[model samples]
Target: LREERIDTVVNFAAESHNSLAVVDPTRFFRTNVLGTQTLLEASRAAGVTRFHHVSTCEVYGDLALDTDEVFTEESPYRPRTPYNASKAGADHAVRAYFETFGLPITITNCSNNYGPYQFPEKVLPLFTTNALDDEPLPMYASTQNKREWLHVLDHCSAIDLVLRKGVEGETYNVGSGIEATIEEIADLVLELTEKPQSLKTIVPDRPGHDRRYLLDATKIRDELAWEPSHGWRDGLAETVAWYTANRGWWEPLKKRAPVSEETAWR
Candidate 1:
């Protein structure tokens, strides 16, 4: 940063797969926790004017599926999985830098993102690619694990808002205020691809799986005037189409890092 004279830094790096974190947690901590500390130190040394850290809503842990309550900026950290715990540690470190060294920093906790070029290991890409190849779409047990779906473009916009207009030393929750079950999303993909629903196969759930996640994004919306322009179904349709047309982009990635049915729970 000193050599380049860059005034801003936005951290989007992380070992961000929940199931993979369970199998290999050491890497997650090293990358998400220690890596963040290193970046904070570098930023402080460089005297960057703005240091924005992108975080996941999983840092708040899971909400009860039966409740309408949503996670807010004030939500206490209750991370369950190794991935969530590592991210929580990073979030704390970011805030600590602001308080201790007076670094200009802001954070945004975003919901699940799906769109073009998503890694094939994630749920949407996994299912979409499997359907395209006439393979089975493995569904975790209960098939009801829920998440707030945010388009990647919208997530980018929210991060931009936080970097430009957000208050210093504050955390913002960025979401679409939309939630859906895994089963629902799978069905939608099947419909959009004109594939039979029988391709979905039920499998055992991962240990320490969070049941649901929804964010209260009122702070970003009301204060930063940020809102998601994409509807759930429309965004999903476009995402599926992108995957359908751009197999060359994702096919190579899927080949490089294949996610098997037994381990693609994230």
Candidate 2:
């Protein structure tokens, strides 16, 4: 980056697998926390003034299932899983660099992102690929776990906006404000693939699974004038079609981490 005279740095690299994190948390800390600090140090040494850190909404923990409360930029950090904890630590490191080193940095905590080129291990692509192959779609515990859905393109747009026009040392919560349960997602995937709902299999939930995740995207929406262009159903259907047409891309990934009945859904 110094050789190329890069002026902007966007850190999106992390060990983001929740299930894998539980199995091996050291890797998450190494990549998500230490790796972030290493990059921040390098960026400062390289004289890179602008740094954008992409984080996850999981760092806020879970909101009450019955409440309308959503996580905001000011929300207190209460991470539940190893993955979330590592990310929260990384977020702190980013802010520390900005405060102590005077590095111009902006952070974004985005909700669940689904779209093309997603690895099959994630929820949307996992269920989509399973439905395409007529395999059992694993559901963690019950379908009551609610998550705010955001198309990957919308997430990209929000990040771009923050990187270009956002204030330094600030954090933004980016989400679609659209929430859905795991059951609904499974049903939709089945309907789109013309598969039977019987393919949905309830698997043992992982330890410390958050019941609901909702983000208050008002800051990004009102301040940055950023909004999600793709709706839930349309984006999901388009994503299903993309995976069906581009089996070659996900097929190899599936083989690398073959989903089974015991596979934990993230």
Candidate 3:
């Protein structure tokens, strides 16, 4: 950064698979926690004025499906998985730099992202591609596990807003306020791809799977005036089409991903 005269830094690097994290937590810690601390130190050393750390809502842990409660910026951290625990540690480290070293830092914890160019490991692209090829769609422990879906483009927009206009030493929740069950998402993918519902298969769930995750993006909305612009249905349709039309982009990734029957559904 010193040699390049970098003024700002956006940290989005992480080992983000919950299943993989459970099997191998060391990599997650090395990348998400240590990597963040290293980057913060480097930014401070280089005198970077602004640091934006992109996070996930998983750090807030699971919410009861029966409740209306959503994760707010002020929510207490209760990470259940190795992936979320690593990210939560990183979030705290970023704040530590702000408080101790007076570094200008902002963090944005976003919801589930689905869009073009996403790796086939994630649910949306995974199911879409699987259905397109007449492969079984693996459902994790419970199809009832819920998540708030946000298009990647909208997530990017929210990050941009927090990076540019957000206050230092603050955390913002970024979400579309759209929630759906895993089973529902898989069904939708099958419907969109014209595949039979029988293609759905229940697979072993990852360890410590969260029952539900919902985000209250009120802070980013009220303070930064940022909200998701894409409609969920339209965005999902376009995402499925992108995978359908550009199999080459994701096919190679899936090949290298080594999806086993146990973890295929994630």
Candidate 4:
């Protein structure tokens, strides 16, 4: 704690909920951008090298659009929400540290993260917890929001690659082979929850909701051989089973608060 025993620093901490950002843009910017800077300043003061900046694909925004291309490390940043814009700013900050100060760092922009221990705020767990509790599942916008999904374990593994084997001053995209729409995700959750028949609730949409997000992981794959072992369907099933079996973990969360109607949809 005193002399920088923390040789490697990982910066995966950020306010990442897209819908939440729409409701409170100022909070999103303050936490995601300013928080990252605060960490970087601390790491710089501590003389830490081997920093890993874990980021998301929403920085690219709207991959389902006819004009939107799959996001690479070099793609132009066109973030839709305050959440993503903040991350984009943080990404630039890391790059600056790498170039000017020569900090040993790797930036990994990854696909949608899913797996165990994920809070119910995210899409997979959110719908799962809500539907399993027999609460109506609130969907935002069109069921067509597409995202490339990666299991949390796989995502952590990819971060390890960036930490250990990834090249310094380079950015890599990490992704699973599967992609799905929001509606399809809801249907899957319903099937897993055993058709309660009354738990489906589709709302209008979130304001400025990104239509699709896709990450191209060729760099991570070709460079570090980071391939995914879980499919969207398989991972969804496994995740559903975990939440179902471990009501002890999620019940408190559902009981603690109701879903925010303000951030529910557009």
Candidate 5:
């Protein structure tokens, strides 16, 4: 930081997979928890002006699928999975630095992000890529799991807004205020790729899986004047189209981590 005269640090590093975290929580802890602390210390020592931490709404845990509930900035932390627990720990650490050492830090807990260049391991990419190749779209259990989706570009815009106009030591929830089920995403992917719905395959659910995650992003909208410009339907179609047009980008990635039944939980 000193050599480069860096004034800001944005932490986006994480081993962010639910099943992977369940298999080995230590990796998530080391990267998400301890790594965040290390960065916080370095930022404080280096006199960084702004330290922004990008987090996940999973830290607020899941809401009942039948309810109209949504997670907000004031929601209590109730992380169910190892990945989310590690993130919750990191969120606490970011706040601690601000309260204890007076570091100028702001945090944004965002919803699921989908767009071009996303690793094929994630839900949107996995389904889109699989449908493109005429491979089975693995639907975990009943495929009833729901999540709020945000475009990656919109997520970046929210983070940019938080960094520029947000108050230090404050945490914001950034989302599209739109939630969709896993099955719905699969159907959309199949439609976009012109693939048959018969390619959908049922797989066992991950242990300790949360049923739904919906974020109430009123704070960011009212405070920072931030809103997602991309509608979910159009954004998802564009994403699937991008994957279709650029097989070179995701083909090698799929080869590196070939989709399998065991690694199918998204």
Candidate 6:
């Protein structure tokens, strides 16, 4: 990317995982922080505008229960994982560059992303494909990890909204506003696959699982008039059916093995 003079730079490269970060903190920082700076530095020198740094809801840490208050653009950074800390650092640096250099940059923090064409390590396909093959689906952590699910199309729409309508030096929170715990999601998968409940396995939980992730997208809605078109239920059904009919697509990828958790993929 540095070799080419690009008009816009979008940084979506990061090894995002809470437990993985705990295992190797340095690698997370190296890619998330150093890579971001390298791209931004090159973009600034090349006169690139409209920088979009993709971020995640893990930066918000655990949200308190009994409150419907979704995170907005003004939420403070309280990332619990090394992965999230690195992303949070990069997010801060983007703001700094825009403020100090007057660069036309936009930042958007999003929630758990799940859909078709996703890597098998992520949950939706991991669980769905495992069930499809009658393999035991593992659930890491307490299975209560609350994640705000968003279809990949919804995320792309939100990013498009930010890229087209968001002002410079601004950040938007893009999410599906539909939250679910890992346990509930596992149940959904089991129900979809017509598998018996005995297939759900509770293994050792991943380190530093965020209790709940929520996003209040009123700002984006009020500004760009964009909202998620796919509800979690509808999206889940479609996702289940997609994996069922497309066994040839995900079967080969099953060599990677099933995992405990990650952002939404269904």
Estimate, for each residue in 165-260, the C-alpha lDDT of model 4 and write its tens digit.
Answer: 989989998888577887788888999888664676777676677877777788889989888877778888999999989989877876766447
Question: lDDT score, residue 265, model 4?
Answer: 47
CA RMSD of each candidate after superposition: 1.6, 1.6, 1.7, 2.0, 1.7, 3.6
Q: Give the Cα lDDT of each candidate.
A: 0.92, 0.92, 0.91, 0.81, 0.91, 0.82
Q: What is the lDDT of residue 113 in candidate 6?
A: 89
Model 6 lDDT per residue over 1-266, tens place: 44676788888888875656776789999999988888888888888867888988777766876577678778888988788899989988888898898878988888888888887777778788888888888887577767889999999998888888888888888887788988899899999889988888877756666678898888888998989999898899899998889988877776664333442221
Q: Which digits, one per residue and each the tens of the lDDT, describe model 2 over residues 209-261?
A: 89999999899889989989999999999999999999889898888854343
Model 5, 1-266: lDDT tens digits are 76778899999999897878877789999999999999999898899999999999999888998999988889999999899999999999999999999999999999999999999989889989989889898888958889899999999999999999999989889999888999999998898889999999998888788999988889999999998999989999999989999999999988885435465444
Flag clash pairs in model 3.
none
Of 3 and 6, the candidate ahead on TM-score is 3
Note the clash tally of each candidate: 0, 0, 0, 2, 0, 7
Model 3, CA-based lDDT: 0.91
Off by over 4 Å in 2: 258-266
Per-residue lDDT tens digits for candidate 1, residues 1-266, read 98899899999999998888878899999999999999999999999999999999999989898999899999999999999999999999999999999999999999999999999999999899989998899898869889999999999999988888999999999999889999998999999999999999998788788999999999999999998999999999999999999998988887775545475554
TM-score of 4: 0.93
User: CA shift at 31, candidate 1, in angstroms?
Assistant: 0.1
Give the Cα-based TM-score of candidate 1 against the true structure.
0.97
lDDT of 3 at 134: 94
For residue 165, give model 3's deviation from the true position in Å.
Answer: 0.9
Error of 5 at 169 (Å): 0.6
